[model samples]
Target chain A: MAVPRELRQISDAVWELPVSWKPGMRVPARLYGTRDLVEHFDDGVFEQAANVATLPGIQKYSFCMPDGHWGYGFPIGGVAAFDPDEGVISPGGIGFDINCGMRLVATNLTCGEVEPHLHRLVDRLFERIPSGVGSTGFVKLDEDEFLDVVEQGSRWCLRNGYALPEDLELTEEQGCMEGADAAKVSHKAVQRGHNQIGTLGSGNHYLEVQVARKENIFNPGLARAFGITMPDQVVVMYHCGSRGFGHQVATDYLHVLLDVMERVYGIRIIDKELACAPFRSPQGQDYFSAMKCAVNMSFANRQVILHRVREVFSDVFGKSPDDLGIRQVYDVTHNTAKLEEHVIDGRRRRVLIHRKGSTRAFGPGMEGIPERYKPFGQPVIIGGSMETGSYLLAGVESGDQTFYSTAHGSGRVMSRHSARKKYQGKKLVREMQFRGIYVRTASLRGLAEEAGGAYKDIDAVARASELAGISTPVAKLTPIGNIKG
Target chain B: MPYTYLEEIAIADVAFEARADTREALFVEAGDALMNVMVEDLKSVRPLVRRSFHAQAEDLERLLFEYLQQFIFFKDAEQLLLRVSKVAITQETGVLGLTAEAAGEKIDPSRHDLNADVKAVTLHRFRVRNEPAGLIATVVLDI
Candidate 1:
């Protein structure tokens, strides 16, 4: 797709489409990426950005990060903020996988100490952690019990002896975001979530065991703050979301918003996928409250998965997780609509910040971050492809220019069908095994679709993120073993 | 083939266009297309469960949207793999009515080869059009 002629280059890594470029735009649309990255973006990014700019009470500009790509309503890696009182809340901006996020756990065991037992460890982890389509976890809750999990978030994990107290502090929003209304969630959604609490669902969701060496640390101080003290440290990462619970919530609300936007509110939507309601409206508040429940459910889900990971490690190494120093570094979400206070035009105003396929990168001294991480800033975990490496970045103080958001992953550049034509799952599995990265998946066709050739280069994305001033590099970790769902 | 797989618009997303002489056949074929994404064989499982669904919308677009969503809801809630056996569509003025009956059995991994889970039917590029041969419906599934 051709880049829109109206887009003007603001800097080597930034482009802008002025409000005049489109008829209904209330503000300009800004895109941040290296020149190469910008050229790789689909034209859908600009179209969605322009459409988002036309929404009511959008502050600053509609923004897209370096990894931005075509998505249903908002382009992946899109960011937009709207005033709580005057603006609207759109689930399309939040994505279907509500609160879809990443969590990093650091262990005292080094690569050298665990290498001889690597195969066994991977096998054990795969066995202990339920994954793949139609897979269920150990947590089977009734309607009342499921609602409790929704309301308590990770606190439910702590009470059920699945997590530690420190785990909550390192998690975003203390792992218990406020405003959850379980009653607002549907009975069908609850039933869908009843048995999926700790399972990793299929499609782009997985658990990877990586090794980070001290030599890879970009900022030694920040790395130490994140508990990366030694070279060749073994760390485990989980990338998942609220599962079917969140999907049903978004699906149900989209129907309501589509009807109310036209019949009751009389608001015109540029795209049916962008269905929404005014933030303060009864319909909007109800969706927000229900979305909070999905968010907490996801938090509790990951917390329980962490407990399972600890058990696998203990079983393999013959020691307790506490003695193994297996502690959570941080857990942050990418897909959400959060009500936060940010200084715009030198005044603190409450706004709903919607980040779709983008990570929240809060700079140092931001409220809600852990006290120990206050000076170092929040940890931003970017999961690269199965073959490429991942990175650990911190939010910069100057990140406020784009509402303090950054890219979530090395975004896909090729279509899945194109990828399947180029790579074979069996051959790719052999290649990964030769590269010392053990690969396990339930479906080979699904594996072929996720070939590393389908996505952009991680190093380039990390560099563009730093150059754009949204996040700063702290450490780089390479994968030793990966489990794909 | 009852349905033809459509070209993907974005990486990892799945879509299909179902066609039949009648609206009922189109709905049944659409269900088969959705279930095939999760399992390799459609005829391997027995009919252990039978379910019925009814939905109404102001237009055909919204009605098809609700119809596809019902299959996903059942898959997640009951662990059932369903194929729509019968469907009926009616219209009076602007209101559209849809009734569907589907039959399937539990998902047993040993017997059925499970594939990617179809999360939900997305609104992007979803449509129902009348072609020269028959009624054709297009759907994009969020996998």
Candidate 2:
């Protein structure tokens, strides 16, 4: 359990734990963090990342983002890509929450314009957005409609009059990932997702109205192009994913992969938590297909949520959504697997990339980027803990160091139990109010667990990613009103 | 003996540390604690069948993780609450060989106040060590 001494410091922001530090490791482990942040990592995270480096066909380095935390198999902020032919895919790499991600929307209305009705706006949003554990939304679909959601993703919302075409243009993969096979998903997973669409499941998921401040605007041109104006323009952001269905898919396949890893692949793992099968193997393929279904389901889930938000805004402002200019800035998934082409040791190769608690920060002009955002790099929405300031970043060329990936959110610094014990929910709410932030949630305990103090300093984490050349800061967004599930 | 809820993440862990003169008795006590965490009453349900598991691992820590993970898997997937009937472990060189028998019953949610859903057992702060008193195992789960 000792810290590896062989790590070579690449820079103040980067450290390299070489492959030679451990036997069987195929690649080095590259960690992105300041000295203080790196020191705070639980030693087991380094051990896990070293183990991930040993996986076949790992590219560049098994990279850990600054917000790294100990997780099953891979560290929470771990990023790894494997060659399609030689690499292996592990369900642990994607974690249990498939396609969990964040989305940011821009608004034409400025903070001054909405200040008079801020409380009413927040209240309406809270009521319209179903939240909390096991909460169900208004979207009730039959099996056939659900299948379309699994296959079409956000497109399903557009067809149902829940989203605009422009929103689809701003979403990654146009809000639907390809290769989803509903048949691959279990009936249990489908049942779990039936009433959960558009519902924000509890634990770290939230909807926030943010005020863009003058001091934090790093790219005025880009912000202006995205229709963000004035020092106090208000924008809404939320983080969520496919609910119970995603969890069930992950649970079912973790067992499937565990059995297959022993019987068919003959692979021995250091921890059962790291259970995996070859990407091309039948078991791996099946999980990937099912995972895609969950991804699409989440896309549709967010789309429906967007529709609900739009409805609330229209009702409050006495203006249509188009007039309010509540357009999606971008949506990106932080969890899930994708087949992507990356330059590996000088050659372009196709690999199945697993980004657990990492977000894709593809630079401007990347082919996979939706055409509308081709001029602007993919919008990276980094959700902070309920008490802190969330960030809007853009992928830059410097991200080539880590395959254009960055931290997903303000990572947990304390366990939920510890947070609840340390801070009373009522006191935390009052403190947020004093800071000009409004809060609402179904469970006070849930709110306490998600308090900003329970997480690492998001500003520092986002800055580390920017300093390390993985992502560039575009704007700093401070919350004025918030709702949690 | 009642199992103490030690800690939980998305992944949860309940443990009972006990001592006995024999290893079999210690394992039985551990099983009793595990079953207590899984459900409310141990005496209410009758064991319909006894299942045996034999596994070999390169290391003892991993062997312990696999053992607990297997119990969780069975409990969640099959609605079967397992009680360790017996256990035997042998160490030869660096490898450990284990044999165990477990009994299970259908799940009754009313009896089982499930605290948290454990996603996976993690190596974070994981430990399995020997003391003069007895064997000790501790783990941090990924909830």
Best by DockQ: 1
**Which residue pairs show collisions in model 1?**
none
Task: Report the Cα lDDT for residue A84, model 2.
Answer: 73
Residue-wise C-alpha lDDT for candidate 2, range A73-190, written one tens digit per residue:
8888999998877777887899777888898988888888987888899898888888764456798787667888998899889989998998888888889888899989887677
Give candidate 1's error at residue A219 in angstroms: 1.6
Candidate 2 Cα errors over 4 Å, as ranges:
A1-3, B1-143
TM-score of every candidate relative to the true structure: 0.98, 0.82
What would the per-residue lDDT of candidate 2 be over residues B1-143, giving only the tens digit for each residue? 32244534422122234444554555565556555543445675467766676767777666765666555555434546677878898888878887888886665534443223333455445566677866665555443
Model 1: per-residue Cα lDDT over A376-412, one tens digit each: 9899999888888789999989899888899999888
Winning candidate number (lDDT): 1
- Model 1: CA > 4 A from native: B90-95
lDDT of 1 at A424: 86
In model 1, state the lDDT of residue A166.
Answer: 99
User: Which ten-residue region of model 1 chain B has the weakest summed lDDT?
Assistant: B4-13
